[model samples]
Target chain A: MSERLHDRTRLRPPAPASIGDRVEDVGSPALLVDLDAFDHNLAQMQGLADAGGVALRPHAKAHKSVAVAQRQIAAGAVGICCQKLSEAYPFAAFGIADIHISNEFVGADKLAMAVELARHVNLSICVDDVRQVAAMASAAEAGGVRITVLPEVDVGHGRCGVNSTEALSRLADAIGEAPSLRFGGLQAYHGGAQHLPVWVQRRQAAQRAAEAVDGYVRHLDARGVSCPVITGGGTGTAEFDCQSGVYTEVQPGTYLFLDGHYGASEWLGQFRPRHSLFLSATVMSTARPGVVVCDVGLKSVAVDSGLPRLWSRDRSGWLRYVAANDEHGVLEVLNGDSQALLGSKLLLVPGHCDPTANLHAQFVCLREGRVVGLWEVDARGLSR
Target chain B: MSERLHDRTRLRPPAPASIGDRVEDVGSPALLVDLDAFDHNLAQMQGLADAGGVALRPHAKAHKSVAVAQRQIAAGAVGICCQKLSEAYPFAAFGIADIHISNEFVGADKLAMAVELARHVNLSICVDDVRQVAAMASAAEAGGVRITVLPEVDVGHGRCGVNSTEALSRLADAIGEAPSLRFGGLQAYHGGAQHLPVWVQRRQAAQRAAEAVDGYVRHLDARGVSCPVITGGGTGTAEFDCQSGVYTEVQPGTYLFLDGHYGASEWLGQFRPRHSLFLSATVMSTARPGVVVCDVGLKSVAVDSGLPRLWSRDRSGWLRYVAANDEHGVLEVLNGDSQALLGSKLLLVPGHCDPTANLHAQFVCLREGRVVGLWEVDARGLSR
Candidate 1:
């Protein structure tokens, strides 16, 4: 312990790289993505979808980049599922065809933007109200494009979507009446199920959601209306979604870059993807004997899930992200005998991936610990 | 309650702006700041600093806008406090003369960036260790620039900083020894106190932090050394900071845009400045009897503090942001008759203002329901 304290872990050794040094050469709190791991995760999801006879519509909201979406499509994804139209705008602009806004949009202005996007790409959107259908119709008419409509049905989680079949039919009928809109299917997603943590809890929740969708589909069929599609699923419950056999397409994101939170589970899966997001912070101060302060903080990383886990430490010291500031991260030397020397670089696996991805402008994509590519988070900060 | 719903509160109605409405004119979810109220908050803080005979170094992390910084400086702020060197890059790039990065910086690459930044702006950065001091000095020598250094001290928030005056003095001595470094004062910010909700808790926390600074200052005085600047205070404890006689400058950022979380508090003499951040999300679907789904969801508005409160709505309907998809917000309309009609526009006050502000690219600054200016969130997505 005395020897470890003498060799502080938080102080990263001087990584003296010239300005021309590739992005990867600049070490940890850097985000590292193993391309092999990423491709395996992608292929596994695709294979699962193909085996289940379902279309893979990967959600781009998890990884809000056109580059990542293009890769998903290359891996046989039917299209992309975007949570917001603003998020879809950039993807659509990048020629990501068959975009489904898996959320409801209400106002005329946003509807117009969606319609405008539909003109350039194949667009499908979800709605939980008749008025939203009318607004979409008007906007699509103005934009001279036909938009596919999915009536969002609440399958639990108590968020958005129609609570009952009656409300779903009403919204569907409203869509049928709109000249510029076509009934796509149904969006039956229970978002709360994604973070169940326990495999049994997650599976049960997905089964319950599927049961709700089954009821909705049967109700529509009884009324002589065929619901062509049922799109919903996430990384946390994609396997359960496929097993349920109710959802026609799964919108699983974050599988490409499994974060610390998702990785914490003991679920059996072959897709061990790499983390692509990082808050490359430097150790700024080490005045305290047992602690080291870093340049990254609350602003640098999203701590809603939990603190970042110390990734890739070569020393005896187990570094912990004990606290954070808007611009500083606190690393505590938990083990006195640990050798995480001062100025020694260390990787941190973020707790939650999505919010962490949203916190950056560009992803410094790496391969074999070398700077291979850099993709701009095109839809980042497009909150409108 | 029924009468209140029909009372037609004096809040501005959603303005129907066309697509041609130059980036500014659109209504709902737009943050409207009473500039007069803002100026008053600025002056009040400055007056306290003047009366207390202390330096007023406002934290720029709250506003993150160059324009706002100019206003703060105009109201008598000596210098601005930033959390990161990168966060301060934009302010420095825009020619905001003086800056103090209230956190430590460690990596050589980042140190070089700071050194590069110091070439233009008058910069002071915090340090918690000797190795970091060496790195900063190396970067400074490489860039041929001098940097002011402040040793971060741990008062509370066990996050970062040193606990001993001996360690602080040692780091200060190390900083002074550096060819391109100058020893500044101390940074004793109690981060945990910022969200105490209760004013007394916040005050008591600040008092303890002040006591730490007093210890350091007395030590410095005994050594025949004069510590000029002692910076650290946030929006929550800024009032108590002015009263404490310890903090030379108080860094409060959230006062410009009081969000639901901050405004929900009943702190004495605490002024409610104008709400300056909004997520201009459109209602996407409203088919359900008592629910409205919006285009903005977890991707658009952050729920780190909690879900955003529906702004300008009457108590007739208790609006709860019950769910969030990537692009959809599920607002549960509870109690009485739901006042939210289909396609009706609504404003939402975010739980935490900073992350929400960081989520947007532009600020549609409004006055009396009319767009006056469009400020780009320049430092937004600068998470790296």
Candidate 2:
């Protein structure tokens, strides 16, 4: 391992630049974050949160980086929401100050890890059942941490969380009854709403998710239970969620590096891609008649949602990535025509931004298409 | 980054064992590579490669680890083959001499990187077109290193490589025309045959691939072009390849870590799976009547091929990973029953072993269900 680390210094370092300097000479398979666009995305979300009269708890799951969260907080985000206890552990340790793990945790070990994180930062975790609340409370007591707990209600994504108001109240009551836990609020996140391709579908999904959470909140109010926060909304449906009035915090992450799928969506096309993330791969082989092989493949780009787009140059008529192995991507030229030559460089816009971001260890900051700085992805793969 | 690394180490370490210790942990998702079985598999391939009189250049793309490659080499492999230059870089840097990149090289910067690496090791790269040969020759001249170059011939996989014998000769002649490049052999890998599911289909594919390569070999021989090596074969078709007499080296990587997809194949089930690889995940939430949440998901496991199998447990009828998000996996209890309780650990056999191996940074070596040692996945995520 020590021997491996010896070659680290040999990696081409990012050239120092003035404010407007265009970064060049950075290697391929890099995560390029456009600072200007990233900042604007943050400010826009903060403005939306303010106008909606709701606290903005951005979802770290979309970015999973403390640096991005800090920028969000500086722009007026109340806190950040994380999807996993393992994912939240690094952010809490990095002094993010406030974090809401919006997923229910059942294991005592993970609950202990969460409670330990709460000792360092203000932590709130979600629970859909009383059994989870008991385990969290026990871990919190053992760790000497008073943790805030939220009842996660399934609004549209039928994965986990309480499906009814009764289940929400039972879990909330359990949290309130526990010595080391406090009932935080309702966590009603509609994960499916983030991927709705049309504006009408997104708006309808947000309305349904909002109504579900509103019903839970009204039930809590009837019982004299004061639920403070209702957190959940991704970048795909952030606009619809802002006007919904039911959500107290909108958790959007991909706005920092909007992907090809989001760019193609009718609902999100107007959002203007930040183009912050680009996988710059060199054309490795252009020998086959109309095909090209690239060094980046499934290991470099995440294709779970869809294939990556040719971001820099849309040689749509000539070539495109057809399939990918673990380390090599296969690009077949269309119509027996090939414009991409050997030794050419190409920029790839990953299909799913979040998973692609998770694949890299660091980010190369680019200004006007040149590398200027570098930032560690910080929490690249903290999937517990 | 250091802090995140610290957070990762907080988890329990794997146990160590003596050479003869046969320890088993009662759970699923635990990667159990049976030393005896793995040794047998390696020896079987070694014997076949030796009898066929071919140099065993086992492909590293499947395992992507130095430890596994070392074992393969020690078992009688001449060196190793890689799918990408980046994949070969780490192994080459770590003193794994005689490496052949089974793919092509075209990008000047990437070609230069490959040439620079050749300065420190015995490197042979593949090229399927004249342009790639020119770029490799240029880079090799610039780097002041002489490197072997192979012409990748497409047998049946409709990906990269030359289509005909004339194209193969033309590529070889182009390489011979280069000043700094030496003509190596031919790369005839049939990627599709590795997943054929049936022995007859696999054998038929191998025979077809062999015929295509034999035509090229005969053409090259008539043209007086020395065809020293004809390298290609995967775990699924290695047996047929050895008997075909067309290949001069067999490159099989997946036999070490037999995945769920490979293990479930009617043709491949005969290969024992306990020999290598399993994903260890903890049951995070099981409060839902017929659903349980796991710590691993799309982010942790590769689902490109299919969902992972609940390894070696009778709960196979009761448990199924029905859905997965980026970080959380939802396991559905089919019969509304599960022996897997909250906090119980489960070992999942991944669908595709290669991509899953690329996700992690290290392999936890366990002996007797406890911490033994840690082996770094030295070539992890080396896509470029």
Candidate 3:
């Protein structure tokens, strides 16, 4: 056990960047996380959580870095929430004592591994079905370990979980009665609602989610069960989740590193949190008169929400980014002054942060354009 | 240097599987490469290359695995092509003597690194302008190294490269005159034409690309410059490229792992090469009657080409994949006793293989449903 623990400790080494080196000197298409921006966003989210008197279990699935997770833990966050057993085990093995898998795990082997990991930490697994509950219970019983289980209630997303509070009650009751399982309140996440793009829509969605979760908590309370925690919120509706009055905990992932899609929100615009994450691509081609080719493509950043916004100065409005092949992004140069020559550096703000981070092995942590640190994305590729 | 080398060796430990463990026993949403199918595709592409008498430089950016590149090298492939300097360095370091960067690289540090890396292997980089030529020449001269250079010609793809043969001739002249560079011919890749969806359109696009490339080659040849190696083709246009007499070599990246987009081609439909790659997801939610949630999401796979197709049998057409949040994918069941309960597994064929493969750290190589090998994506995050 000591040997396995020691081996896992050195999972990722630091990236190729020395302190005080410029961001352009690091590498092309490298994931850059501005430390100043990250710290500001972290404090902002923590402040919101504190004001509501709720625990902050920021989703570790966003950055997938132990360094970021530890920073959150240091800043009054109770724990971190991972999305898979693979992600949860690494945190547990890395000595993170409190870890909750905000998603579900299936298969006997996966559940068994989750149960084994639970023996090392305060582990909570989510389930929306009696079958998943029974599997978790069986795995826990087999491992001779008690596991915390959460019943997910689908608020707005028709993707998973019980649609109603009544259905959630049955799953919660089953979890409470399971032989080796302890009921951990709820996983009431409105995933689709988080990207609604409108302030009122997102707030209303969070309000509805909170109300539905409270209804389930009431149902469980009347049946002699107590709700200890309720965690479900994302970067989009973090404020609404906090102000909803019933949520004891709000899980907001993407708050530390805002993407263009989430950053477009009016609420987020008011505070003006820095764009913490960026993809630094190089101008790979400048043969054409009015177009330039960049190195960041679909392989380096996600385009699900939209094409990445050009974050480079002096060329912002003059360059239009068009998603091309897997290895290239074409930027149309609108003016003569916007001459993006070969070897010139261009920074891109990813359309979505989570998947963009997943494309990188480590973050080139910068401070004012200088490389100050390197954070290994320890849980990267942690999707089971 | 040895210490850093040792640390890099341990970057990724063996994935959770021995030689004979079942696929389900491994992990959910893990990248799986069926070895038998992979071998078949490798041989199939090799056979085409042999028949056409053109060298096959299978683009390593598809799998990013040294294992896959080595197998290609073993199977009559002359070399491998990478899209970035960072991607090429790992292959060269892993003992691939011949490596080509199919795209232009920018930034001084990156160029210097490429020059340094070239000292250990046969490195060839692409350029489409005189500025890139001067930069490469300066770097190579400073490093006291001789490097191979390719001038890219834009063949109907307005993304990158010189648009006309006149421009290509000028660039070729510059490459041939560079102090520390050897003019290695042209990169005529029409990326836009690779996914025309229609057979005749794809073929015509390839023909047009070849005609334009030949015209440029003739232009260079007329000026007493030798076009030694003309390289460019892709999984979507491999046959068309081989049949075209102008291209001395073809770079086909995705042939070994046919995704749904490329696999939908009528020409590819003829031979029916095995779908070598897959994303295995677990049924995380079974609460809703007609829908089930899987662990694979936007982070686990790319949705740029289209949503992934359900590859598992008995429920293939019954389940329609709907992309949800970063952590979940919803599958709607159409009909029948295709009961996908929690813990039950489903296999998905990615819409596009390259970007999806980029999301994974390692490929869980399987044969007959059992783990056979673990291939670390040596250049997975080498997108610098």
Instruction: After superposing candidate 2 on the true structure, give the runs of residues whose Cα lies further than 4 Å from its correct spot.
Output: A1-26, A268-275, B1-37, B268-275, B338-340, B366-371
Tens-digit per-residue lDDT, B1-384, candidate 1? 001112122221123333234333363344334455566667777776787777788877776776777777878888798766667767776667899888765665677668777877788888777877888888788788999888888888776688787887888789877879988888888878877877777778878878878998999888877778888887777787877888878888887777777776656754444555555545555555677666666655767677887765563257677766545677777764443555556677787777776776555655455555556566775543
What is candidate 3's lDDT per residue for B264-349, written digit by digit as tens?
Answer: 87674323467889988887777778777888898888889999989877678678887656778888878854244666778899
Report lDDT per candidate.
Answer: 0.71, 0.74, 0.80
Recovered fraction of real interface contacts per model: 0.38, 0.34, 0.52
Q: Rank the candidates by lDDT, best first.
A: 3, 2, 1
Candidate 3 lDDT by residue in tens digits, A135-203 = 788878988999888888877776677887677777877887887999988888888778888878877
Kindly indicate the candidate among 2 and 3 with the higher TM-score.
3
TM-scores, each model vs. reference: 0.87, 0.90, 0.94
Worst 10 residues of 2 chain B by lDDT: B9-18
By DockQ, the best candidate is: 3
| Candidate 3: clashing pairs of residues | A107-B343, A384-B28
Model 1 chain A: worst 10 consecutive residues (lDDT sum):
A1-10
Global local distance difference test of model 1: 0.71
